[model samples]
Target: MLMTTNEPAPAAVSDGMTEGESGALYRLMTWLSPSFPVGAFSYSSGIEWAVEAGDITDAASLRGWLAAMLTDGSGFCDSVLLAQSHRAVSDQDHAALSEVAELAAALAPSRERQLETTTQGRAFIDIARAAWSSPGLDAIIAACGGPIVYPVAVGLVSAAHRIRLAPSLHAFLHAVVSNWISAGSRLIPLGQTDSQRVLADLEPDVTATARRAAAASLDDLGSATFRADLASLRHETQYTRLFRS
Candidate 1:
């Protein structure tokens, strides 16, 4: 399962350009592309259940939920895992990578969220390796078996593609927020213009989340979003549902 990349690294940036500027752009596009096949469209991260609970029924509520999630729940946990995974791969510590992977697997509060992250993670790694052909990625894929957790896969790909940590973290947050917002658009029936406005309002929160993630330590990983977790758990028994989680 050794990952192999045939494409040479992009030519070194010119004197004025920052390191990895081109690689960051390329990686951002890959991660953000709707066609990346991560199956992001299928999971709502429990927003549907929240909406049903009447906890979230408008743009303001959706924004609050997303803010809490980014600061206190899966977003924070995933950021820690992503950082650890990056270090593990950089150090060639396969054991550490596996540990972080397991942590990521356990981080999800519900079955659907667990499945959503891990399934897409495994797919992302497989596809990214095939398309990018990086040996570092190949080694990681081989070490981790076939199914790597999403954050770990993201960290590995970030390293393989030579994308810097800060921008990569921002991209990760944006992707998470975008998925939820897209789900909100359907479940709450927000207008397209409203969706765009909501996204705009979310920028500051997204940037703050990324900054915190960039500075976060493993000690900061605990979550207190009990209501959100309960909703996700209850989603299993939800009689009718639109989103998977």
Candidate 2:
């Protein structure tokens, strides 16, 4: 008989400076923590639609779909936005910051996708201000002058706290993956062990994607995750679903 375990792959050691001059690292973790009231659990990013369509029926299929998302779809686009926001914040380039924030919000393919990013983003900013107030949050808010996306808000807060870009991006990407895995576990009804295994298998892909995002610019952004995008659009009309997409 086969057995299962919840053990995860060992994480790579940090680059040491991630701790920052103050409590930057801890706050960064708090902002991205699964418990963060972003309502991330409510949206499946169209994975629900895909699952209902039989595109993700098992662990292997879930893993494959997730891998493609991390590398090319909304995941890649969000990473780029996060990376740009990090740089813009670090430079205090308010114009660039606002531009990217607007672009990120506008690029959402469907109404649900827009709601997913913007609502979570608005909640993130509000909760952060209430509990983790900082000058950085204010700066980003004033600069943005409009709606924020989840990743952009995170980037601004991290930059304000003097957190280094690499680890910030790494943590942000990991949170995105973790949220998906959590959604997959429920939607796919995978065993905890299988979910953990899928996350473990994605370790390298996540790291590489973050690294590439750090070096990428807006011009480098594009998505070939066509099926995923369509699924997100279709989720708008999915007859019965457990997620809001």
Candidate 3:
């Protein structure tokens, strides 16, 4: 079993430091940085398979598919898991944390999706431990006997970095949407302008979804099923693919 290390608690904030101060911006940026070594760049989350199947071949279709995914698929499930993980870590409730971790691991729609999330999650946990040195994080790592799902890792780091749930959720959704759009632009051969337009249009939906997710509970963790899951499972055997997922 892999385990996180425990370090000293965060230092007390200096006088005059506001909760919304610019100092938080640096922490947020570092968390969302592409070079953070979480290895998020390698997974397409089965979008590549969708494109190959002609189910998502153009900008409009890609946007629609991604919107559905955000509102109904992994994004929703991940948000629920992240919120639960945040609460668990905040309260130091190890049993609840383990429950959330197990749910997150089981929520993956396909083998590749499972591997992608768990692999990146473990990597992210390791990176956070080495870079931030938080005691709470170390505890979570120590408890990680099973695969560390990505959303759990994200929540753990967000809590360690003192990022609030709302912005943290937004960042998580934005990262997923942005990565998929980046992959779609190349896979579907979408024009740069079109890709930008799709991203712009998605901003409102992403924000709304984040808000919805913030308010969701574990009981609400359900998906549309069939399309997303079937496509992902089929992607496993897709030939001549540009993506590993």
Candidate 4:
């Protein structure tokens, strides 16, 4: 159960500047919150198949699987795409943005993976534009010429909102990781505390991946998590599926 927090956003501190930062923090929290209308909860990114296959049976195994993802698989790939998209939008380089968008669209290893990302992506754009309309978001949609990939959509809007790439990418990846853990929780029937423990254990991987991605170029995009890919593939045939992927 990935739940949204109701705690108030932090107030501006006396760190030479606090006002400008508060809105960014609040926007990130709201945009990435579990309650955000992205249908993120409906897709397990193949975790259902992994659990069914006994590949993720406990917190330790779940952490290990997700660590690989954050460092070398879809997690890392999405980070790079997001970073590159952010930079592209910030630089106003429509060509680069379009290239990244095309690559992201073609990179999904499975049809369901494609569906998961594009569906959430299109939703993100429609929702964001309605609430936080910006030329940057419109630019990404124009470049994409159709549905946007999830990370690219987030990157475009974050840039449009003038949010820094580092924090935005980190937040996006964290949400992705949390969604996966939530799926694992329900599938493995793991306790809530155990689920949280796995999330805590993956913080290092998340931070390291985010840092690496912030400085990465399009060439850095690639996924090596073969089993994770296979899991999504196998999930297509998983008859008792509780997830779309």
**Most lDDT-accurate candidate:** 4
List, residue by residue over 124-200, the lDDT tens digit for candidate 2: 88998888777656866889989998989887877766677787888888888888988888987899999999999
Higher-scoring candidate on TM-score, 1 or 2: 2
> What's the CA error at residue 223 for candidate 1, in Å?
0.8
How would you encode candidate 1's per-residue C-alpha lDDT over 169-191 as one tens digit per residue?
77787888888899989998798
lDDT of 3 at 65: 92
Residue 122: error of model 2 in Å? 0.6
As a TM-score, model 1 comes out at: 0.89
Model 3 spans with C-alpha error above 4 angstroms: 1-20
Q: State which candidate, 1 or 3, has the greater lDDT.
A: 3
Runs off by more than 4 Å, candidate 1: 1-20
Error of 3 at 2 (Å): 30
Candidate-wise lDDT, in order:
0.78, 0.84, 0.79, 0.87
lDDT (Cα, tens digit) per residue for candidate 3, span 110-224:
8888888999888878877787776667777666557889888988777765567777788788888888888898899899999989989899888888888888889989998
Better of 1 and 2 by lDDT: 2
Better of 1 and 4 by TM-score: 4
Best by TM-score: 4
